[model samples]
Target: MPQGPNGYDLTVMHPFRGARYKDSVATNGRYWAGPLTHFAINTATYLFTYHFFANYSTEYPDGFLSEQTLKSFEGVSGERGSFKWKHGAERIPENWYRRQPGNDYGILNFALDAVGALQALPYMAVIGGNTGEPNTFTGVNIADLTGGVFNAATLLEGNNAMCFAFQAVHSAAPDILKGLLGNVVLAVSKLTDALDPILAQLGCPQMAKYDKSLLAKFPGAGAGL
Candidate 1:
């Protein structure tokens, strides 16, 4: 039987998949016990959690990726120097020391910037950047670039839909049971949205072509990668 108007079944959807992956580290400790193991496991776990959470964050309810103000720390070294309190004495002239930018060694920022660069490649190619013209580069073509765009856009749409749906249900739920039911709905919606492209590629006719009318209703639908 269907669980909602969308005919989605909630039983198979795993909304807590991120939490499960995080928990698995503790449950299966042997897998994360070697050198660089923590790095590998934590990377995978954080990726999943970030994907599931999408743009939602308790601290930043409006969105998570906002422009950060660059912080300056010009006098850090002199402030922490050993001889700063000597009366009438020139504070240690830490000429070799310099203030560091907050994002100077931000690993997360570097990774995010790299991903952003990769995502912009297709657009750059369209605007005459050297992504290799169609048939010019052996084994590389425009379809591959467009397909990547399509897949990325689909995934983004899925994430957005999941976040919007979750927020709607979460806001209206009056009690614990209703909240649980809302979560179930959210899980199903998220799974279905995410799998739509895969199912379409697998020859599901209904999933292959999106309805133009529906697209009119949802502007984000136009961003079909």
Candidate 2:
């Protein structure tokens, strides 16, 4: 059922009961980066239609959205966001965003990077040179670091996952995609593990949701984040 880093579970069911979260997310009304519209008219028409029926779109109540790049903005929870689902005890929307949004994405959560890969993933190495770019989920640009900027040492050194799972997916080989997904899950867990104490240190209980136990089931991705 699990596929892709953001818990792209294929077994996801219908509107209200089984897959209600995704359905709700479809209506969440926030514009994410990089969704392709067939044409400007099509895009405008969709937006117009959405806005026109904003109050009553059966598919989405909040509205349609795409995804965001990681490590692009500053002050972001460094915690990934989550799926709209209400599943396991740990599976909660707030908790997922507390971890890495694109990495080991909690079940049914989606944050696909532009072009479905981290062609230019965003991240930082504060201990080294301080790229000086703020990090966040949306409006991020490519991070030339272009490789793994992870591990306990990296964490202590002030390095950010930056690209999150989008990096793993892009950096992987064609045959290694599936394994890369697992790695993304591991990375999300790792980031969450790293994020928890830091948030606690900062006295932000609001950020606790991004902790490890919540996002235990990272999916296997065949596609993008």
Candidate 3:
């Protein structure tokens, strides 16, 4: 397999990789340099957004909910069912879920490049092999071309846990981000409800993708998002 029909490892980077701050921080240039730092962005994003919407709304008009109080609600929604859709391949149709927006909407699409980067690292050891097995990595590991290669030809791991967890903390991260955005929506929803008896306001309402009109409940007594 070659190109140039032509050049081998010429190392010429495309110009588009050098983009703006919000963009490049994920894909082309992201690195913790180590494990401890790999998903730092996710934790930070989760803490902040969770506080703003989840933590804030639960206690507002009264006080803030203790951090321990809210953990009781994580992923506890009662509605549950089995997913029966079976495609010949794992590919999902574009309309099936909320689509990702922007170039680096998640953690940027590193694609095969991420595997190449891992293979090149001389330190810390390689951990797995083909068929998801682990073996002693040899200097010849590159020739096998296996590590992260999903199809034995390419690696498509742009949405690793670290990447997804980071995106989940932001409103831009689709419905799951709602776990945090839910707070803000709840806050405004309650504010709208409490004020419905007398005052009419525009600022607090169904805005953006979240319908303020739909989130009319505050879970329990004396809580407002």
Candidate 4:
């Protein structure tokens, strides 16, 4: 899901234009820009969330995460943890981020004594721009970045598939799930390929390859790694 662009630059020749014309231009710009920006941000957030979680949550011998880290994070082994639906739904008391770490979301916590010290100047300065006027910062939205139930579910499916793929690769055995996920990745990578120009322009990271054999092993074994 590649968003072509978040916004545009409109240079209107306003010397002879009426006030209504200028207002209409501004209103129309805001109207279309709002949804375009929203859609772009939403799509970027989902992709970043999925790729970040999928890559980071992976367990080692193949991925960066260690077994103990997975245990501590999920309170279960990587294999078992992958199947569990984990997200920030309020109803679930054991939602991610509730464990040993402090529940307070840092300086934003209202209960803190230094709440007054947290001045609005800095926020306004950054958000309002150097000219002391309102502006838009188009970037990752952290609040919505983790995503919701659907994201968790799909991530689990992909992660579980990755786990199975790794297992099958190690055992030199074929797994249907591994093949399915691998094919999905390959297929999706095609879209990334098509959007490479835009993605590169934005400096967005793309998942290059898992294991070289991920593509080869599922359909057949005994190929070189």
Candidate 5:
């Protein structure tokens, strides 16, 4: 089923048998196509997710929380819940959650490709089918195809792990920043409370208010007042 001098032979590339023939040029190429495509997709996702989280972490280390910690305060109480929503996803410019499905898919694909790549080598060895010669015009030799699959699997796993890690970090960034800001405001309020006595002795107006409403917003800000 080799092609004509100027055109591809459809019989050689038939959907059912294109990848089954040992000597056909399309065999090895088609056999490895699925894993290769998965590898490429995971690699691209890893790069994008890694850079996003890396840049974000570098730019805001103090405000970066782990996903677990972010979730801890998500629906705990009224103020914390409002804080999470108001200063977190609601205010952040980017849609971090939108990319989650892609990352999830990448992880699943990585698992499938890893298993496929591992099985491919053993399957080829057991099948005992001749991979033909090493001529460039025909197709790749068995050794080259096996090596390529191994390398692609290794890279795919590594990239998939990186993508998962970065995605977690990116997803929690907004909540972490919100918490940091809330703590800063709380600290400032406490400092103002500490200076109340000094202002009273100097006959100056006190800036710190122990009002119930304000204390409710910055809980523990009026502890000593």
Candidate 6:
């Protein structure tokens, strides 16, 4: 049986069959490996499709802010206006418009719109109905798997935070000041490991044990993400 990221046996992913009699010849040889192989292949194909779409889509938009509004905020802050959230939906804040500046509001709006459009393209292509598109799969629309409708409020809040962080980093003093700030951030990251035991005690999700076998491969198989 194949082991998962946490060293647990993946019984469902790879089931074992009992020993066969020597006189009995298996008629369906493909049945043994076919399903698992196809599952892996299909999974790999979809994952690659998702990665390619995500990387290429974000590159074209430049900043989270669109081209039309980006020029307005170019010199206002030395920071790059086009920051993107890795987990876009989760990072968005609840209230954005009321607290952020006017220019920031525009930039946030542009970023949200661009992200929404770019994200939707892959979903549409993979599961969109018969709209005469080349890559669309008419069988079933799985766009909802991506997420629900875009929440402008949450997106704005997240973008505002992202832009603010970028601006703060850009505006920070050089030399000793920057070095101190870097050290603080590094310390915080290192200390985060200490919280794992506390979180586990509180019944929160605990970190998975590192698997050396997955050193150069994807580390999320059977992780139940």
Instruction: Using lDDT, give the best candidate's number.
Output: 5
Tens-place lDDT per residue, model 5, 18-124, is 23333433333222212222223333333332223321233433223323333333432244335444333322223222223233334344444433433443322
* Each model's total of backbone clashes: 0, 29, 6, 0, 0, 3
TM-score winner, 2 or 5: 5
For candidate 2, what is the TM-score? 0.15
User: What's the CA error at residue 27 for candidate 5, in Å?
Assistant: 25
Model 1, residue 103: distance off in Å is 3.4
Model 1 residue runs over 4 Å out of place are 1-102, 123-135, 138-225
Q: Which RMSD values do the candidates have, in order?
A: 21.8, 21.1, 25.1, 24.3, 28.7, 22.4
> Which 10-residue window in model 4 sums to the lowest lDDT?
7-16
Clashing pairs in 4: none
Candidate 2 Cα lDDT to native: 0.26
Give per-residue lDDT, candidate 2, residue 45: 34
Model 6 lDDT tens row, 102-169: 22323334334333332433221121122232222122211122132212232223232222222222
Q: Write the per-residue lDDT of candidate 3 for residues 167-217, one digit (tens) a residue.
A: 212312234334556576665555446544322221112112312222222
**How much does candidate 4 score in TM-score?**
0.17
Instruction: Please report how far candidate 1 places residue 76 from its true position, in Å.
Output: 31
Candidate 3 all-Cα RMSD? 25.1
Off by over 4 Å in 6: 1-66, 75-190, 193-204, 217-225
TM, every model = 0.16, 0.15, 0.17, 0.17, 0.18, 0.18
